[model samples]
Target: MATSSICRRRSLSPRRHLTTSPASFILLPLFSKKRTMWCYQNDRCKDNFKKSFRLLKGCASERLSALVVVLLLAIVSYTLYEVQYKTGIEIVPFLPIDDSGFETYNEKLLNDVVTSKAAQNQLPRGSLMCWVMTTSIYHKTRVNAVNSTWLPRCDSSHILTNSPRFLDDQIPYHTVFNSLPESYYKLFWKTRLALLYVYQNVSSEFDWYFKADDDTYVIVDNLRKYLARFDPEKPYFIGYRLKRRMPNNGYNAGGSGYAMSRAAMRIFAEKLFHDKSLCPYHEWEDYAIARCLASMNIYPLDSRDELGRQRFLPWRPEQHFHADLTPSFLMDPIQFWGPSIFHENLVSMHHLKPDEMRLIDGLLYGVSQGIWKPQKAPNSSTSLVNSTEASPMEDTIQPPTVSF
Candidate 1:
């Protein structure tokens, strides 16, 4: 009904203009008019074309913008799906190696480290000092399990913590960094500050520094045996090496724990942590430290055994044991890692509960030792077969080692 009224008004308006004006009556026969939709005037035709083109252009721009947004969202979603952190998964941050603008390394640098290992001694006597990360919340639970099981095996061990009772407790808890609030986010600062404390106070007393999470269980003797293969005087950051892209190379997983040779500890404790330009404050403690180390040409060292079995595992025993994906995911599981979860003489396993910690200790020390003692064969070398003093599990004897 409204359209009929509009049509009636439109039809009458042209007739009304014609009847009212003698100019329109004379001009109506010319066939071209400026205001009419079908006008063939050059200016009117050009204006109409411009308006139509603008409308079409606006519509196309909107469609293109929507298409771009959808494509961007899809790309981001797929990237997130690929890099999402799962239980015991190694998180690969989408950080370009040049973002830090630190030193870059090549294959030769890694080759040198491997070659240097050949000149080092096996099972050398070295003082291993371990520091564990803990908060007030884990003090009674995970800390106690750590102390009872593996902490004693270290030549000396200190608990790096934020407990209010740091000095009041009889345990050798280091509290130089107790000033910070006990927050997980602040663990990065806690980790760096803890290293500073060890550097200042007791670094001279140890040959190697092993840092671990409180929930991690360490086969300290196996760790000692592993570390003995590298020169303590040379800088080494040894752990479960996560394969990041170029320049970044790799970094030790913070959860599984890592060993720093005395030289590496000294480098970090004395210089790297102080220089924010080289090691800027990052939310990730491991990556920040890694960047600092890499700036000085001290990249992560492969802590795998000769047969390519992993020594430091980021996941707990079951999590690693039942893993289905390769660490890097570009290769088959067996090709990337070994056929099994990890080396039999694994240095550390992380993400354990308080009960699991005690359970692992019992299994390695009591159950396995009691059930599977391998007697020294007549032809066996060094003769420390199934020796508890040698390790919780007997590592195959190295050459030139005499009986204890």
Candidate 2:
């Protein structure tokens, strides 16, 4: 039995050896890895790789968020700097060109008014003939104002300009020169040309030649009353006198209005045509006229009220009434009308702008006809107390010192 068992054991041992050999080879690596702790190490390496990748991604997202916030702040700061202290551009109004074909007239409109007045015979023609030194811009409005209000009272009326339009019959465009004067300096030539025209055309037609700017408003009735005493035959030149420089022989303030008698016009015309040097060109047209008259020893007549105030207002009414002229009761129309003396006897109003000119015509007309009365006096306050109360003769006849 021992022998038989030994043979069987020996046979099984060979088979078991063959199977164990292959199994041992496979299990040998697993046993070696467990001994070295390689399984735990591999697991740790994968976990560390995943954690590193997540941290890097989180850092990149934070950096991108900070960059976006900084960009927004930079954009807001620049916008505030521009708004605080920058000067903006200025916008100006457009002035239209005032020229149409020269020597045109609104005759149909003029004839309707003139003939209607003549038919009514409400306005009797006076001996004074008025002329306005006007331009293209003032024709429709300014000239029309004179025509509707005061010009009808005069025996004859005319406008002298470079290019006459809207009233061909009344406005005589002096085509003597190439063009009309547009600037203040050019007025010297303009006045020169006007004087020549007056000399040639209408020197003998009227007793007095009244000259004024288109902006000036004249109370024709009051003017007639004022000149009733003065003879037209005498060499009379009357207006607001200005003698700003030495040898202050007064010259009429052109804007305030002036009147030259027929005798004076004749003399001026003769001297201007015959002796050109006597009436030389000047920067100011009024100054040039004064120079011409001064050469002939004819000075401007003083036109002032008995109270020594100027009848011709060279400046606006508002200028005379201010804080400087205190004791404001005199200017208060509510105080008294009789003592409200500044413009009570006012004849010619000057320095009127286009809009103001349109409104003042009716006011002046109403005042002249006793329909509207002045309630307030002007503030004739001066730096020197005595100057405000000076005599009319002294104030008007004396040399005036003015700056250009």
lDDT of 2 by residue, 218-304 (tens): 777777778777888788888877764313465777777888887788888766434545865455567668778878888887677
Clashing pairs in 1: none
TM-score between candidate 1 and the true structure: 0.58
Tell me the spans in candidate 2 whose CA falls farther than 4 Å from its real position.
1-126, 166-178, 321-342, 364-404
Model 2 reaches what TM-score against the true structure? Answer: 0.53
Query: Candidate 1, which segments miss by more than 4 Å at Cα?
Result: 1-126, 164-168, 245-248, 325-339, 371-404
